[model samples]
Target: MAYKKEHVKERFRPKPGKLLDQVREVMHYHHYAIRTEKTYIKWILDYIRFNGTRHPREMGKPEIERFLSHLAVNRKLAPSTQNQALHAIIFLYKYVLDMPLNDYIDATRSKKQKRLPRVLSQSEISEFFKHISGTKELMAKLLYGSGLRLMECIRLRVKDVDFENHQIIARDGKGGKDRATVLPKPIREDLRLHLKGVRKLFEQDLAEGRADVYMPHALAKKYSGAGKSWLWQWVFPAKNYSKDPRTKKIRRHHAHETGLQKAVANAAKKAGINKRVGPHVLRHSFATHMLEAGKDIRRVQELLGHADVRTTMIYTNVMITNFETLGSPLDNLDND
Candidate 1:
């Protein structure tokens, strides 16, 4: 059955689209990505329901602020969590609700500063890797070896790996920026083996009369045959094709990050390491280890694709945990 929107298929159901159409229309006008639109709508609905099903239209900015504050202050969400909620509400006001969020909310009530990222020791990393295998092992290698974010590792395409140049080209990183990272010396062989398997899969798909692959966004429309091209195939494709809503086409996406997350957890337990290990931990370990090796901070900043030097500066602290080495201003008290 073809469903027109993201709602129940039953004919007698009250249908959700009518309730959220105005909100969706405004977000569409602002050119927000469909994933973001869905997220913001879901958050908005949660906000409304949490406020005793009071219509969001009836609530003021103070109420919205309180809800976000509750997430941070009471629920003790991380800074990223607070920011995600904030971005959703901000989008709802400026785009969906067609109002100014700044008009009612004070500047003093936003998310807190981000602390330095948690990193693992080289030995710890090796032990962690010993416990994982197959897809999870490859995913972790991308995170640590290429300095990729969790999503970036999963979203990689076959063409993104420039073996000739020994670099991994990351497309659609944070802030929609694309950059390249060094391909680790160790994984060159592994990637080559992985590519051969992918080639066999691609050939089989072609033999089975699969006309094309899924290209990113409107690229498929512009070049109808581009999907079948080797460049368009994901480096880590899902086992099956998903039905794309907008075009109603079946396409293979990359593996879900949650699978890698679960893998990391099991590996962490097997290794008997207590610190919470996630894919981002590998990225942090990459940055911190580079800094600890006496690499130039500016270069580390570039390699990590950090926009601000201040963001990169945080990693230096991650490497040098002993604050006593800084020779604190309190030393003047001893002289006095």
Candidate 2:
């Protein structure tokens, strides 16, 4: 029953023609977000197609520079969009192809836009919420109340909320950071009632043998069966199960972000607010209103998870000018 040594060697050798599969494996190993995995793959495929599908291993810096230039000059992409393409290619070479990029790529950079965020006033905020109801309304409330990004509100897990402390622990927020934020007292009872419904859905999922959600950073392995646990369930679960892109297993996910976006947009339109408003506008309103209410900018920085106070200071530009804070020159003259 002896086996051929060549056949044995063949079994251990890596299979050919699976570069993208290899990239996916590497990304999974690094615990990249599912959305990021999809986005990176898209950019990589676009790069390949733009260059007539030449294998990435055959291309180097000149080709990389040329493609990035095309994105800026030809496609007229934003700087962030071009940078995403660059990062995808860099990841492919560095991690998947085992080749590192040079210190400088020397490509034409894309256009940078420094537009300020759109914000809603307090009355407009009231009007905006009046037009929407149910889960989306709750999501919008949390976005404005907790100073949460749209996706941050979407991805909240059950265990991350602290009802007693009146705070929410936003897990894995933008830039891979986490922060604690205040949960509005007004929404507490509604949120608790909402969770009761969600818990019932979780129980139903368990009874029907479909109660599992995605976990980050190989946590699903270390804490096997934790995915189906009540604490790990999404605070706002999707209405349906879908195939996970990485594992190919059917798992329920957080509510799709687009649905919330559409709901908020329609709600804004129906509310007859003139200015362009979206989920992010609510976040902007949160920061502005907090500052207006005399909350310290540094404290707002921590709650909003801003890396620097400079970033938080953008909200100050939208604050109403308080001339009273600087007594009028006429008043000063009268005093003198």
Candidate 3:
């Protein structure tokens, strides 16, 4: 006797309240980054909650369009943010719910404007450093020196730093790509001394049988012992241990990004040379300064891990040489 098709389908379907878990399992199977998994899940949950907890199985393209329009017209989300939410919903329909979205989604798209990045002068950078001290100060130097995004600087591990070569191997940067950037000579000794303190902390953690730090890509399972090793430890470990959601393993993760951001903001305010400075401003300053110092634009693109040269070209607009090189037609008329 043959089994019924409906019975087979029912056996395979997820049980109630397990839909999100299924989404996570699919995301993990495809090797989506942890951040992406979190973001997608958040948007999906918000979408469900916004529609009075209606199952996505009952929703279609029309519902998705209205939700996206609400985000733009009501929440005033950035275009990028609105687009991200749309992608998350699309993924849910296509993958999780097994429903296909239309080729075109009609919605009120958030209007995004082009804005030039803010850069700090060399003197302003010097003043900004005066207010921050210790680890926060070192982190700022790394951001400006290496042109690292805030997450890239904080996510660094011991193995990623190359002192002898004067470079930093930034792993899993934006768009899930890696690139190398120069590690300024001025911060080398300070970084070395800071590592000495981190090493002591790691030793203490090991003594307490809690040396394990968070590892990605199932690396902890593959190596079995790498998570507890000094080489894989966070270069900037958090002061306290937290429970990992998946494994419930108590581990010391990286320093929270917000803490460093707030520290930088306070430092900028204390220095009183404000042009809306933040950790990212330091990165912008790095790219702009490299261009000003005659570094090749292509080389800057590589160091900054920009996928397109056009993104790096934005710095050229803010460079002082653009004005310095300009000569008015009135000035040239003197020759006539």
Candidate 4:
């Protein structure tokens, strides 16, 4: 029985490599998203560096607690950021190193901040659009018009947009869930014109034998040539080809999110809107305006692809309130 147990442990041990490489191998074996893999690897590296380059196997729960506490107390990271680091370290120890942490990690937890989502007024939305043009304008419109998250908009494929049904399918959205969202009728023609250009790029890539886009999960193997097909092409392809970070194969990816992020920031400054703005602010505006127009909260929740109605309910708190109809108590007292 002792010999059998040792044999089993040897058979399941991780392949020999540097620790980060081993982490990547284990993460890939579990089918983690590339973004998630990158995030986890970064945090794990930070954890190792914080502990004076000590091997993680040498340090355990107390070291983790101190690192997390430092992030909360010294670095002043948000609660979410601290949680991310904790999760990353946990993944490293538990999965890659086969060292599950103890239940109690007494880290100084970061306080969760209760902040409202920033939304743009309908008039402000119009003003913001006036300053943005070209592809960024269309992308911004999708954020407001379709209630898409920034990554969702960036990652859209050619077949995801359904003009006939007047809906956009957000495939593998947040939480790896798929949902359909509205496609504003007003932007249909603009979207079609934009696709005509994307189609040309697709054809060019095909002629050069470089048309493949990244496929999710086992689909690349299941379908074989689907990655090279028109249906899988990015709706918003990058201006130039680049090497895939993981595969090292040169291909055109979807446009970088930073371009739209910078555009939104610059447009907000140019339009003179005071509040901090980003791509997500447009999504918040979409939810708020939808509710303001008497749209059902349930319907808005579906459109936003929120897992819970409570998550959508936060918009109600920030929705426009009519002041004229509900005047102050001083007005009822006949002030003046």
Best model per TM-score: 4
Give the poorly placed runs of model 3, Cα more than 4 Å off: 1-16, 28-34, 321-336
Question: Candidate 1 residues 1-336, lDDT tens each?
Answer: 011122212222222465477666655444445677788778788777778888766887678767877776677776665666667766555554555454544422435666668888888898999999986798889899878998888888888899999999888777768988889989999988988887787777777766377566567678988888887787887777677644567666667778998998889889988898888899999999888988898888877889998898888777856567867788768764
C-alpha root-mean-square deviation, each candidate: 7.5, 8.0, 6.4, 5.0
Worst 10 residues of 4 by lDDT: 1-10
Among all candidates shown, the one with the greatest lDDT: 4
- lDDT preference between candidates 2 and 4, better one: 4
- Candidate 1 weakest lDDT stretch, 10 residues: 1-10
Model 3 TM-score on a 0 to 1 scale: 0.88
lDDT of model 4 at position 78: 94
Select the stronger candidate by TM-score from 3 and 4: 4
Model 2: per-residue lDDT, tens digit, 1-336?
A: 111111111112223568788777777766778788889999999888888999998988888889999999999999888888888888787767767675578899887888887988889899898999999999999999999999999999999999999999999997789899998999999999999999999999999888988888879889999999999999999999999877898978889999999999999999998887788999999999999999999999999999999999999899878678967777757554
Which residue ranges in model 4 land beyond 4 Å of their true spot?
A: 1-13, 332-336
lDDT head-to-head 1 vs 2, winner: 2
**Candidate 2 C-alpha error for residue 162, in Å:** 0.2
Candidate 2 RMSD to the correct structure = 8.0
lDDT of 2: 0.87
Q: Distance from true position, residue 28, model 2, in Å?
A: 1.4
Compared with the true structure, the alpha-carbon lDDT of candidate 4 equals: 0.90
Q: Give the poorly placed runs of model 2, Cα more than 4 Å off.
A: 1-15, 322-336
